[model samples]
Target: MDNVRIFELAKKLNITSQKLISLLEEMGISVRSHMSSLDSKVAEEICRKVKPKAQEKATIPRSQEKAQSRTSEVTLAETGRKKPVQVSPGISLKEFADLIKKPPSTLIKILLGYGEMLAINAPLSEEMLALLAEELGLEVEVKTVEESLLEEGEGGTPELLESRPPVVTVMGHVDHGKTTLLDAIRHTDVVKTEAGGITQHIGAYQISYRDRKITFIDTPGHEAFTSMRARGAMVTDIAVIVVAADDGVKPQTVEAINHARAANVPMLVAINKIDLPNANPEKVRKELSELGLVPEEWGGETIFVEISAKNKTNLDDLLEMILLVADMQELKANPHTRGNGVVIESRLDKGRGPVATVLIKKGTLKTGDIIVAGDVHGRARALFNDRGKRVKQATPSQPVAVVGLSAVPSAGEEFLVVDEEKTAHQITAERIARQRARIAGPVRRLTLDDL
Candidate 1:
């Protein structure tokens, strides 16, 4: 009995290993860690004093408990009233036990009865545990992750919103000339600059047309670059899908449509190579209309333009249509606040250390500003525009290459500009810790029969 581990004793008392360690130390017990063995007499004494207190703590309303502690149930004795247990989506088994005021061992027994074995801290979806809670005579109210984010975003006032440039993503099939269309608009040979004539990275650039500016994100059109295309759609205000006039719609074309639709961004189809002798703009329109992109000329909402990238015809009309749809959407973001944006791409450079292409979604990003992106943090050492010119700051809807990240962040990761280096480092540390916990923690119990 002297070989009893401290964690096993904590389990029996329904408390965390850390809490049990503190209690043992208060009793003059010299345990060094959760894995330390405790004498039978000392373990019994500790359990006798800790079990009732743990039960009482478990019944306390989560609102009044320590924020560091797991959320638990509302007690009838404490308030002379009953309240439905608050459960977040994907609640863990240990949290479920606390919310229902049941011992983890009891929950394990119930799971075994249903032919399922799960780790005590394994997460379970609300849908999988709803019936179980009802059978146990406990009411559960679930709150989803999306609802929380929406609530936070809705708290912003209308006064902070200002008109911003439309961010457009060019997407289509490989060799469908998405880059060539952008090249024709910018009056630069981008396709010729890429290695092997294939764009391997996401590029962000701003183009001025008719005294108005539009930010264009050129995403790789290959099927293997699906993730890059999805990220492009996420940060953009609109999608410009280039379809070869003679080739009609293809597999990657369908995927681009789906990505734009999922991001809820309006799409304008660009029928390229219309100058070719075999070009068929009408056929391309009809095929895309079948995929829910009915052309406005056909009495539908979608705007379609036929252009020749090589000949650069109707390119101005394409730019005008992009502004028309952007004006209708009334896209805006405040430029006076702290900077926030999404990482377009990142890599380690021999001369630059860590460099990233970031698209500024809101406010202004400047040199010396401490930036944090996912698990990375650093002060902006330098900012360069798309044209390779050094810039002091970038405003909303502008993309700049920033050089000074501690590590290259994943594409599509949201970055925020904090006031102090300490805050940036703290945020990076906290996020890194959370990610590690999620990876090292118990495996999620996905179903009733999961073992």
Candidate 2:
């Protein structure tokens, strides 16, 4: 009976083939054989043992019929299509609003009028999910019996609710110990630890200070940072501007400040080289003030900490200050929801293939999560922390390296996890189309004098 064909079981049980498939999926079983080849004995056994429960029709409730009807009308009116909305499981309302170009408040009102009490931060219900899918021109269908069976066979802990860490980018001039400072914070000589003493590209690392985790993006201090800023990708969350105490603010320091301002991320001034003989903290603060980064002690919005990355002085204070700023911003995202993170950097690793260092903003990412990275999509097979240690899953405020992408996603691209591979590919295609549209649009002309 268990091995009977799905169609035969559906016929013997007097149920729709689709409904039978749904039931099998719910029971975590798979149906393989066709109806014509189904063994009569097995089909009879399945028919005798399984029967649909007497229940109400699978129709919208009377109270919600008007809302559902309106939703269907709106979807058709907008897209000129009568297809049902396909709501991917585990996506958040804010994400949905961004996807459909509607304000979250408007979406919430629409959902509330339909008897859904979901908050902006709350997870979507199945009925509400259906409504959203309809509005977005997607198909809704129940899981197949085979899929349910597969899910059961892959027993693993579902993602937990956790806050993702912020992606921190360090910007300063050459010889500012930007790499050395990161090595000191992470307690590894990554600079010298590399094959060569030079870091050729952007490297991402995750460091834990007490229980809190922070992801650091080591961006090239040369012209690349400026180039990245011009693109408006601005992949960094917090900018740690390293200013040598003795050297004070150099020309590159000023450029770093402008880059941080252009990206619109908060800045923290770290007065490095304080342990040196010629290091002067007061002089550096005065110089920084001229660049508009007034220290908090001097009634400025920016927080300045004096430290020596070489001797590891006041490193604890630096970490604590970063966390303090993060708290003030209320940097949080629901990890139990689908993955929503930013790509700090991407590269091809010889051993791991295509790898992306992502700073999870909201939602949790685990092994096997199908992710859409810009124009690329793939299922994550391995995750590595900033220290290059393998981890099962990364939560909010975590920086992790993900492998198994179809291609190298662009740096600063936003990542989202989809419910299936097909949906992931669809999203990637849409993003590519949008990018093409942007490039094909008119280009604005600016005079050299503007510089």
Candidate 3:
């Protein structure tokens, strides 16, 4: 019969049409009639060829091989010696089930019996797989680097890598030299370089120290460092909180601290404007203690460093402290893998189209790499560092401004370089469709009185 009729028959038999067709193709069946005109003899021959042989089923014992052969079979009831599964990147429940020839629902039920309480569609962890394998008498082994790396050139690396960069967000009250501190760290005149000498938009910068890299997100205070803090929390590995020694802890400074605390990132305090005559580091430290940022000297976890952006005092100390925290936390990456990075900020450039400041967390970002940032996808045409120098490639922990995006992606969007434009376009289309669905729904409006 024709493919459509073959599919109809396969569905009637409660099997996947594709599977049935594949079986028929393998058996050399070439029926091409419509559903209504198919000859009974031809149909019978097709069914006989596609159906599993009775002798094949008889070869293995029912208890041992039944579940292994049947796609619909599941081991719901737990065995006594169940091991927990640890979830890793790119693996899904359906794929796991397919590997074991069991239904996803059956696997999910087995996980729930072991206290996982996961849905059929929920992502499966290695721990979950281990548990399932233990109960089902399957061997569990850790994936090797060679096998994982084999997928790199083949474009099969998972979107979320096992390891990620530590997100460092810069926060402080208005005009507390937060931007200046970031500019000083990156050696960029971002504060004075901006159109109005004020960072009206959120900016992302990546700084390299002794072969290590740390990302710094510069957020605006006039608008409630909310967007900045949110981005920081989403990807942050740590927080560099700027507090003016002359001004002590102001309202927004307190807010920034709260954001860092809420995100649970380790904090390092920068007591800025140390060059000022009225600057008081001791008083600032005491005030910060009241706000719950007890410095390390005071037996708390936070580290406070006194600095002056104008005179660049104690800048080396600040960098060293950041590196110390990162090292203590074991900040590392496999630089030989495919490139993955985070969007520090995205904006429409007047002459360059959509420009994005992306921190290269791992691998190398080169010109003409097809990239997708959130819903926006495009190839990188040009890359520039904070110094405005054009570069061909950026390695781990380096930040670069890239041009030639299809559109301005949102700030804090994660980006990945893919192999082909078709794949990028497909992913971008799916993301845009999801975004539309999210925004198309009725939105709850908050009135001014709600405040």
Candidate 4:
């Protein structure tokens, strides 16, 4: 057997490197650090000793478990406090401890036991604050800052969250009718407007179905747009896999499925060109079923709809299934909070300094708001909808083209509105500095662990 480093061995054995090192020192093994290596015989002997101790750690005594049950079983609601203390997110550890009237060291100890090693000044997420509060037998409310919400004209985290429209992505092989399907859904000839029927830039749009809305991302079928397609998958709540009935399943069709699955989003199949005499919907379904996407009609969970985008047939069924799946997810957002979302696509135009197509995931983005997108920040000079009409504001699940970014942000980067332009500038400056440092940093050599 080959020798292994202390840390790697500890990881394989499901124990901490420090604990293993301590055990080695107790056994007079004299391992220097977590990086120190041991021969096979010494490693086997160490494992023999460590396994029994690991079992002891794994099997807690009934007394301690019973004691833990009484505290762990009690949730915040069970505390029954008339007025709960509200904790704002992203507060520093020291600040949080001060607010809770607990010592910073005590909170640090709790976090350490919970497998976190944070500095006293390190920012704490709302979840961390809640965990600390629970450990102290206290009930605390976690929410976005009320002042920021009020400034943006949004109530702080609404008590009853409003349902947001589901963001859907249409993906498939090139010339397999993805564009035609989108045109049928939008009832607009977008390809006709573009030069040579090829879009200069594709982003996203919205369409109403049965009084409800669905956001559709215009992802082209070029290999160059694979990253953009992956980004679309990440933000999309549902992915519509458009497979040509005549062509069945192609390599790109499988690639699209991989991207959606990688993002862990739900998928629906659109069997396009079904009106063609050569169309084989069954063959398409069989190929897809082999890839783990069996249709619901065939006793699988994946939804499938045969549609002729040219004739605009069965499009209603597709939208209905999207809404049905979205309802099952209970998709919602707190529109009462400051607006924030992901950039769909961005570019610097000759006429317009910098413009970005963004999909709003939560809250509302309004005109004149100071927005920060990655390393760039600016005030929203204008907002345009999918139809190119100027809009005063965009609500949750709405995709709109935005104007007035300091620089074109990369697609998939998150954008959020700040209360002040000064804050936006400060944030962008910090992010820019960090990015530069990363770029300027020396190249790191690969390690065995990296493999």
lDDT of candidate 3 over 105-143, digit per residue (tens): 888778879888875566767677779888887765544
Residue 401's lDDT in candidate 2: 90
- Spell out the clash pairs found in candidate 1: none
* Model 3 Cα shift for residue 250 (angstroms): 1.2
Give a tens-digit lDDT track for model 1, residues 145-252: 322322322224455566789999999988889888889888888998898877888888998887778999888853323454454525678899999998999998
**Rank by lDDT, descending?**
4, 1, 2, 3
Q: What do the candidate models score in CA lDDT, each in turn?
A: 0.78, 0.71, 0.70, 0.78
Count clashing pairs, candidate 2.
17
Better of 1 and 3 by TM-score: 1
Q: Provide TM-scores for the models.
A: 0.64, 0.60, 0.59, 0.64
lDDT per residue, candidate 2, 1-451, as tens digits? Answer: 3455455456456554556555655756564322223456745655676775543323223335446557767888898765433344455788667756779997787787777777787866567767866665666544322223223212222222223466788878777778889989988777885545555677777777778678887877645456556655455678999988888788888888988887788999999999999999999898888888887667667888999999999999888778666654545444444566677778998988999988776656899998887788899999998767899998766778999998898877778777887677656665676689888998778989886
User: Candidate 2, after superposition: displacement of residue 246 in Å?
Assistant: 2.4
Which ranges of candidate 2 are over 4 A from the true structure?
1-166, 194-198, 222-235, 442-451
Q: Under the 3 Å rule for N, CA and C atoms, how many clashes does model 3 have?
A: 14
Q: Relative to the unseen true structure, what is the C-alpha lDDT of residue 90 in candidate 1, on a scale of 0 to 100?
A: 63
Number of backbone collisions per candidate: 0, 17, 14, 0
